[model samples]
Target: MRIVFILVLAVGVGLAGFAVSIAKDRFDQYQTALAEQRNAILPTTQVVVVNRQVRYGETLTEDDVSLIRWPAEHVPFGAFTSIEELFPENDELRTVVRIMEQDEPVLLAKVTAPGEDAGVASRLEEGMRALALRVDVSSGVSGFLRPGDRVDIYWTGTGRSGEGVTRLIRANVQLIAVDQIADEQRNNPTIARTITVTARPEDVAALTQAQSTGSLTLALVGVGDITESETVEVSTSELLGDVEIIAEGPEVCTVRNRRGADVIITQVPCVN
Candidate 1:
């Protein structure tokens, strides 16, 4: 009876140990699955951003920026992922072309190329030229125009028929600067005397001629407005609702008589 009792007790202990081991393995698998699910839900990436407010024409340095973890799926285009990408060379640096607030992402469009200055030339793309136009308060959209805004240019001058005409000279032209101010953050109403724009070679020529021949006015385009403008021209007569009328006279019929050598032509009434 003592021998049988010892074997049963030993078997019972062995079964309890196996059950505990299996439970421990299942708990480990549960922990690993939970970690993988958390990672998938909140994936992130490191992005370089400005630590302090940086203004236009200011040199960007290593100490002025920091890296933060941003959502991998929503990262902005042209955002720098690492410090080395923003500052490629130790000896060279880039200048800010637009104002960047604190903690803002450093974008390629807001900064100049390495060793380049913040100038109008840097803002222009290939095959584009910067052109300046003279403007006053009335013609410059009451000093509410900004650098990044699009505008429609109008020309007011005398027409070939000796009438005053106002026509749309250019549509959807982008303004790069207003009176030497290229910062898009500027909101104060400034009566600018000159505004700079980027245009193709042909447009530059046409704008230059239009500026010299007559007065030019700027019409501000709304943000995200991509509607194409039609050919718009207004004359002084049209503005006053004047219409020209033509009067018709009675029809006259002529009868030709062949006399000896000369033909005689006389007006006669039509029978029909």
Candidate 2:
């Protein structure tokens, strides 16, 4: 029994030695491989890991490159150097940069078309094109004419018949985009209200004529109706003339005494 116990103790000692030897061999092999890899690539290239956090809004400039540095341990895995494992000291492996914000300047202009008057111009903005047309704003009739208001266009023309009587030519016109930029006018103290309208090279003359002869009345439409052209055409005659408006008489009256009331006011006033 004493001999058997001694034999078991010797076997245990042998096994422990063998395990230590194996571990030492593996560690040497790993160190040799790492050294070889470092010699092969470390001189020619630099591997750095970032230490800070970067955000999406941050801008990177060429001058910011000096903040990166190499990590402590170097090892080779298949293709890549196993950067994450070997470079445990690196958090971001790059530098966190902050970017500055800037504001870009812009210019806006207001333009008007012929016969297209102020009421129409006010509704216009910077990016619109004007097709000149005549509109009638007799007195203060078409609502309170202002910039940015959308209106339907109506055109009227006079046509001579064979019998020498004048026939009325009437049709609907589209009030394209308003030509003036309200924001620029309101914001800039020096800028006046102008409107932009879309027009062909040829229509400029007809628009000017329409402004002179015909009357354009604004037909206020909903926001959805203001966009896109359904159709456009030249017509003669008046649109607002078709609608009759009643005016109230003066509110206050003056009274005269007998001396002034008996005077004959008409026969003696001829000045040729």
Candidate 3:
């Protein structure tokens, strides 16, 4: 009876040991999988982002911004990784040139250079000039024109034939300011007496001439619109859809005969 009891105890102990071995193997596999998952995570870097909504012309300060861990591979171009790079010691503070929302990453394009004001000049690209055109409620897209919006300019005046004509003068012209406001976040539809646009030097000269001799109208372009406007012109007659009818004279046949050095011609009825 004692031997039987001893054998039973030995069997129970071996079964317990086998169960422990299985659990240990499963725990080791789980630990290996967890380490691999941690290694597979993308590396991150600190990026400067706005802490609150910032509008154009507003000054950007250290308090208004914070650092966040952003994916290193997906960091935006011109992003400032450190606060020191964005605000150098003894340098003038930077100003916002474009609207930036909360938590938005600060980019070089959205802010002006240090000490630079948020003006139309900051919005103009190199080799581009800003020109202001006179506009009313009617010619300014019903006062819905805003900064950073694109527009198509039209000129209406008398042509060389002394007839009224309307022609598309420019297409996809970028507006930098509406009246005195340069903020792109302005949504109020106030009638702007003048709107400013940035264009090349030659384009500015042409637009000046057109504005001087004719009325300029602004046509708002749709957001993200990349289609270019084709050459378009409408004359007074064309607008009325009037077609000119030319009077056709009766068809006549002519016969010519040469008699020595003299030639004789006779007109006769035409035969089909």
Cα deviation at 121, candidate 1, in Å, is 1.3
Give the higher-TM-score candidate: 1 or 3. Answer: 3
The window of 10 residues in a row where model 3 has the poorest summed lDDT is: 116-125
Give the candidates in order of TM-score, highest first: 3, 1, 2
For model 2, residues 1-272, the per-residue Cα lDDT tens digits are 99999999999999999999999999999999999998876332233222333232232222322222233243222112234422234332221112112211100111122222334343434554356443333411232333344445444444343221222222223333222333211222222222233444454555556546644444555646635545544322233235566999745544444565584333333344
What are the TM-scores, per candidate, against the unseen true structure? 0.72, 0.26, 0.80
- Encode model 3's per-residue lDDT on 138-255: one tens digit a residue: 9998989999899999999999999999999999999989989998888999999999999999999999999999999989999989998999999999998878799999887999
Which clashing pairs does model 1 show? none
Instruction: Please tell me which predicted candidate would have the highest TM-score against the true structure.
Output: 3
Candidate 3 lDDT for residue 29: 100
Model 2 residue 48 lDDT score: 29
Who wins the lDDT comparison? 1
| Model 1 Cα lDDT, one tens digit per residue, 13-124 | 9999999999999999999999989878867899999999999889999999999999999999999999999898656899999889999999998899889998899999
lDDT of 3: 0.93
Greater lDDT among 1 and 2 belongs to 1
- The whole-model lDDT of each prediction reads 0.94, 0.38, 0.93
